[model samples]
Target: MNARLPERQASRALLIGSSRFSHEGLHDLPATVNNVQALADALTDPAMGGLDPSGCRVLTDPATPKQVGDAIDAVVNEALDTLVLYYAGHGVLSRHGELFLAVEITDPDPYRVHYSGVPMTWLRSALAESPADNRILILDCCFSGHAVEAMSGTASAVGGKLDIRGTYTLASAPAHETAVAPVGARFTAFTGELVKTLREGIPGCGPLLTLGDIYPALTRALVASALPRPQRLNTDLGDHVAMTRNPAYRPPSRSASKPRVVSQPHRSPTGPHRRASDEQDPKVAAEFHSAMLDVYRKAKKEAGYNAAYFLQMVQEVGGLEAARRLIRAGSVSSGFTALWEKGRLDLSVEAVVLQDRFAGLFTDEELDIARDRLAEYGYSSAQTS
Candidate 1:
């Protein structure tokens, strides 16, 4: 272990999330990807965690052990003052009571566990031996508690009595429990609340919040959700370290600050009257809204994404009336296709305008689905700038 210096420490983070498993029995964890993204965003948000973007390394759906090992080595070698390593995926406890982090290609067979996943033993050793004074591990997976147990099991096995003197480990669930993602939510339960705490700030945490300060609230949320309580294990950290700088977050003012005086434009009474068809009934409009949302939901499910860009594009063309007609005609697909052919949906423009709005929301498969949708409407992601 390296000696702590008198000066301020540089910081680096490595975030890993594995969603797809090649093994037939192991189901994919779609929420892991979202958790990784949410954490990344929180860490990089200037008013929040404020870590330099270049110092953060992210790996998603990595199948090979080399990919994971190399990433871990790269970040650990940096020897920064602060190092945060986060993993969200399937975690298995072996027959020997060892913990293993599953990768995309990890076979579900119990006998093949050694070859399929990374051992928590190796990770613990790496972190313990790292020069960084502040080593933080955040695990969001089933059996995450096993990793912590393994870390403390045999200190000598992980580099001479396991020098975890300044390390902090946070696990989403207990050893025998499973970490759950809330229904219809984009992020896993643990991370969703964590991000909210980071972004919105916690009362009495002051202007700056530390991982230690946020732990209690996080524990409360998990318990309220009926989940296994999250655990935070620390080894001889003398003082709490600030994880993020919370801006002066406040509820928006309920009443408008100032009312603007507007001059009404004069209209010609003899001009053409508004079309009765354009003035859709409130009930019909509500149904149209619901139907439009259904179409978007279907598209998202098929595409495996939750980007708002799809809704924006649909709204750009025909508004609610087009959606009403499609639902009424019992032909959402073909109607959408017809709208595509009419050049009402500009794929390229929408992609550019909503790119940031939808960042980290679309997976490769979802983008492909969106591409297919565009093709049916005579457009392509490649063709769009």
Candidate 2:
């Protein structure tokens, strides 16, 4: 039966979301927590699909780090078939690649922080200790990096093979950007789409939707629609991950009715996306530039990266085609940056050209249009940025 296959053991989901918190109160944490509760309910409903709630334990929202840590500690030892941790609140990341998913966090403070958010290192250790051989983490907060960032580089196959455990982290954005919450959406854009893709039974959903796939989907969609795009950070040492293209996966149908959770809202997770296509429409491409410029502005206002850096990008880089592909890759894809870091070190005209304002920062390749345009300025290489 589809209800029970491959694995019939217990499973657990730890979820958290925070929003609209007062200087001392939480804002929108309830919405994401509520959605997770619904997801938990659906997972428990034998009539709809799979296992019973008895097979799983859930930790929704804990006001303190110790509370969260303690709750997760209990779940880790439960020996479930699949262990999932979903956090849907505001997240903050440090320059050192650390991440935090807030619970009762009222204000942003790194040390002596309010409302403890479980650290990625700690969470990963918990996963390492979890009795489950398969562990999946669906992080809906911004800058939810750490565990995933640890797993980013190409690795060699040592010993007989590299098979330890299955760990998947779906972070909303890079550790450096703000996560977007759509105007009327119950939760943030990343959480909404994730629920849709996972529930839609879309072919590209689930374990197939790797960090690479999800990172781009959120960022690109955010950039296209004028919402803030989250940076995608990931980690997987041995096994391959399928990003939104897994054949065995299926999304859940649109809820015929809204389901209530313990003490929160009854909003649906899946909804419509609002980005224009760069590949298909030239007009969209032009608009995207303006939209990205806005993104550049917000990045400066919110994060404080040098304005000239982004301004140089918008003014110097000419075409957006590469950006489309770049954001789609999900990772930082800092293509224009690659020239300085990897290809050109001397800051040659090529290096400077790579950093051109109009040049695509999202990708490395130069589209035909970009190439011809650059040629008009004396550079002939149409190669990706």
Candidate 3:
């Protein structure tokens, strides 16, 4: 069945990660930090999940169960169309075999976990009570599949069977299997694939990615990687709820129209004016560059601002140096005018140069030049859409 993307303004997401644990028995999952940040970036990306930046909240190393509970409660109260809850880190079992999410202060002792960690029941209850039509829960932790049982009313630890009518639960591992977090990996095995799937998208999927579309992809990826298989539970057509735009979707090609020919002045080949075709026909070159820029802009708009490979290059070499390299490589040229003319100020080099994270990379004069160029194009920070 065809699935529809959620309304960005009416959706809310809560991402919780516990990276640092106080008890020595539980090793610190440094990868959890990257997991939360990358997931947040993917979800809020205009070309992907398209959630409002304000609507997605990240709570890392939460100090207490109350803190996590309160954050979940807040988003549950505000979300109207879709509510997404994601948690990564350690999952401990209570003495009664119930699942409890580890926090910074959570002890490894199963008896003490009930008081120190956030119980899965809290999330189950939240999902049961949420007013949103579509509720999604993603757990990346050890024995996360226990959540599936809890949601299905088979787990005795949850006290009584709970109704999960409009929810979809995706877990990283089976009840007995431990989720993998390779040493020095940027993210846990499960979440790394999840983020990659969200960013790169499934090639054969429809324009919008739904829970059902994502699950098989995730399973195939995990199986290919030799990782533990993930599990899920869906009810009331929860699997059809669209989560993000598919980055890999391609429209069918149509016949191309004839190119518009512009008249050019005759040039002397023997004089100093002799040069390349672009130099001879500046208008034609500008048009070519404009077309190339359009392709780049379309890619950025569909894949996401952070999903570009150039952004990674910028991150590795610094933004200004990356720009210099691109210029030297002749992969890019002065195309601000082209971008401005096309109402794609978001794709302007100035937008990247002036980003707060790239501060101190460009000189004040260079920044001023970028700002002036954008201003000339009637670009404003508030005009992003």
Count clashes in each candidate, considering only residues at least 3 apart in sequence or on different chains. Answer: 0, 55, 0
Q: Which candidate would rank higher by TM-score, 1 or 2?
A: 1
| Prediction 3 global C-alpha lDDT | 0.74
Q: TM-score of the candidate numbered 3?
A: 0.65
The TM-score leader among the candidates is 3
Tell me how far the alpha carbon of residue 281 in candidate 3 is from the true structure, in angstroms, after superposition.
64
Q: Estimate each model's TM-score.
A: 0.60, 0.50, 0.65
What would the per-residue lDDT of candidate 1 be over residues 85-193, giving only the tens digit for each residue? 8998888766666678999888756677888788887788878889887888889988888766656654222334667767878889987888886666788888888
lDDT of each: 0.62, 0.47, 0.74
Specify the poorest-scoring 10-residue window by lDDT in model 2.
268-277
TM-score of 1: 0.60
Q: Write the per-residue lDDT of candidate 2 for residues 30-80, one digit (tens) a residue.
A: 566556665565445554344446655555555666877887787778755
2 or 3: which has the higher TM-score? Answer: 3
Worst 10 residues of 3 by lDDT: 327-336
**Tens digits of per-residue lDDT for model 3, 1-385:** 2478778889999999899988898999999999999999988898685689999999999988899999999999898989999999999998888899999889869878888999999999998888888899999999999999999888877776666787999999999899999999999999999999989987745677777767767876797789998988777767778777889876433421122222343643222222232333545434434433544556466533322444455557644455434422211222333344346667766665444433234344344445554564468733422
